[model samples]
Target: MTVTRTLALLLALIAAAAFAPIGPARAQSEGPLRIEITEGVIEPMPFAIAPFIAADSSAEDYTGRITRVIANDLASTGLFREIGRDAHIGRVTSLDAPIQYADWRAINAQALIAGRASVSGGRITLGFRLFDVVSGQQMGQGLEFAGDVDDWRRMAHKIADEVYSRITGEEGYFDTRIVFVAETGPAENRTKRIAIMDQDGANLSYLTDGSALVFAPRFSPTGRRILFTSYDSGFPRIVLLDITTMRRQIIGEQEGTMTFAPRFSPDGDTVVYSLSVGGTTDLYSLDLTNGQRRQLTNAPSIATAPSFSPDGRRIVFESDRSGSSQLYIMPAGGGEAERISFGQGRYGTPVWSPRGDLIAFTKQHEGRFHIGVMRVDGSEERLLTASFLDEGPTWAPNGRVIMFTRQNAGGDPALYSVDISGRNLRRVPTETAASDPAWSPSLP
Candidate 1:
């Protein structure tokens, strides 16, 4: 049989094996498995991950690491709780081994994951199957991946993504990357460089040498390029850098003008940013393909931090036209604008969610900073975080979580992530003080 057909047949067999009758003790969880994002307290669902079997001696070294990464990814979301391995009645020794449903049910494991890892000829292979303990069935198809050994972590992330999606009925964000500004030295004279890392803070590497100050690193839709603000010429300028070759060039450069807070259009063919000329900053769009520039906003006030909606037809930006910083939305072609923020605080850094349903922004009010989201029409505002200095909110690819910069009084800045429901606020690990986090879409 062909490889694809063989894999399909194997998955069919696995599914067949999981169709055993459900047990009485596990009957309570017979319905669909899902986690609802809400403001109320949630009891995380309990799941069990059997240590992945090493199908070959060469795979033993990677089995433990892959399992740990998958466990961490699921646990970090706070929606799934992992049962300790010590509590398990038996272990998964092979890919086709029958699951001991009674043992897993005894430990109150609603979901179970079993996987196998094998390595040969400089390539690694991973396979995993998720089971619904209550129904005594496989949640979905058994999946497998083969890639270079160095890409083992990404394969693990893909496995985690599959398990998460099969359970929550939503797209997973674990197989992604984050670009941010890495800062060193004291707060006053800090040196900032553009850096990128995996979502779990592994595989960190710097894109810039810290010779010039860089800020607000935004990933392109393809995750192959980055747009950021650089102060190399003693002025803030928007620059585009290719992640593969590390080649960079200035964008929308004009004599005696400054540009910052650049973000890519949904199609990655254009860039929308704030350009300051003669002390008046306004929003502009640059066509990257043909080197054409169009003014998107013409006002006597400071208009900056422009972000494009997912449809690429409208732009949401922060402006001080009303004498205080607030959010405004306008057509991509530059026309009449509508104010979208009407609250007690001054709002800035408005980013439209990838789902095109809501906008996230930074709000400062009454000596405190907040990261908040609101309906596109500016209603139903909900604040997700409040701290001494929290700003620059960026949404995950799935639009369910927001990561932003948070710094306490007399403390250095760091990256933090919070669910849209304001649960599971956690610090993102970094080698240095990190800020201006931008999440990339899932890797191809």
Candidate 2:
């Protein structure tokens, strides 16, 4: 059979098996399998993944690797727990085999994922189905993905994204990327380079050599370009780098002035950044199409770290206009601003969430640093982390998690992420000391 027809037949068969009647050991709960992320302690839902059946010898090498990545992706979220394979009473030997729902429910598995893999002519195809074991029904229709063999990991991430979205009702961040500044050597003479990596710290590649000091690498909305502050010419300047061509151009440049902390507008056609001239710093927006600059904030105090709202209607940034560093919101076209942070600490590095409902920022007070978030109007302020130093909070694509740089006393900085609910704080793996993490939007 042709590959397309074969895939369709496989999905039809799985759909048939997924709808079969539940046996005697079915769960008592009639509610759909779901997790509500809240402030209270949550018991992780248990899920199982059967070994992906390999359709051919060429596919054997990838089945285990793909399955492991999928499991890790779900487990890292702190919402799903994996039921070890040793506890599985039934094996998934074929894509068309009927699911033994009784065996899965007997082990308290609320969700079951079964997959099949096939390889032919330098391409690999993956098909999977997610079943809500407790409800004894398929959570969604069976789906399949095909890609080059070298992109197996991305395929696995795509599958995980589907499963995550189906159960959590939120977009998945598994297939996104992160851009950061990679540091090496002593604290005083460290070399910083622009680096990019997969969300799980894989496929690491340096975009720039350690010759110039790079900071605050921000991804464009399309994830095809980057904006960062570079000190290559002995002064900080905003530089735009194209990921596909590796071409760099200095933007927002002015004679005898410095510009930094740049971010792209929602439409990716304009850049908002801080410009410093004559010891006075202000925020400015530049249109990429016609090279027109519009001053957003004209304050005597420092105003920097400008971020645009998702709708491109307003901008949120940090300033000391109130006698200390604090976050403020103003119209995107430049007008009167309003202070949004009234907390005890000094706030800076404000980032507007992709959802446009909240803002994430870094705060410092009484010898401790924190990463926090608050509603757009500065209500319901919540601090998600407190440490010796935590700064530069970046939201995940779904706006459910925030990643920032954490540093202990007399130690190098590392990337750390925490759920918005103030749980599941964990370090992000990287090869060297890293900071200034910028999360890219979900890939197409």
User: Tens digit of lDDT per residue, candidate 2, span 1-444?
Assistant: 122333453344333222222222222232488877778889888999999999999999999999999999999899899998899997878756778889899999999999988998888888888888987876666767776788788778878987887788787888889999999999889899999999999899999999998899999998999999999999999999999899999999998999999999999999999999988899999999999999988889899999999999999999998899999999999999999999897999999999999999999999999999999999999999999999999999999989999999999999998999999998999999999999999876
- Could you tell me the TM-score of candidate 1? 0.93
Compared to the true structure, candidate 2 yields what TM-score?
0.93
Q: Please report how far candidate 1 places residue 211 from its true position, in Å.
A: 0.6
How do the residues 306-425 of candidate 1 rate in per-residue lDDT, one tens digit apiece? 999999999999999999999999999899999999999899999999999999999999999999999999999999999999999999988999999999999989999999888899
RMSD for each of the candidates = 5.5, 5.7
For candidate 2, give the lDDT. 0.88
Tell me how far the alpha carbon of residue 250 in candidate 1 is from the true structure, in angstroms, after superposition: 0.9
- Report the error of model 1 at residue 63, Å: 0.4
C-alpha lDDT of candidate 1 relative to the true structure: 0.88
With a 3 Å backbone cut-off (N, CA, C), the pairs that clash in candidate 2 are none
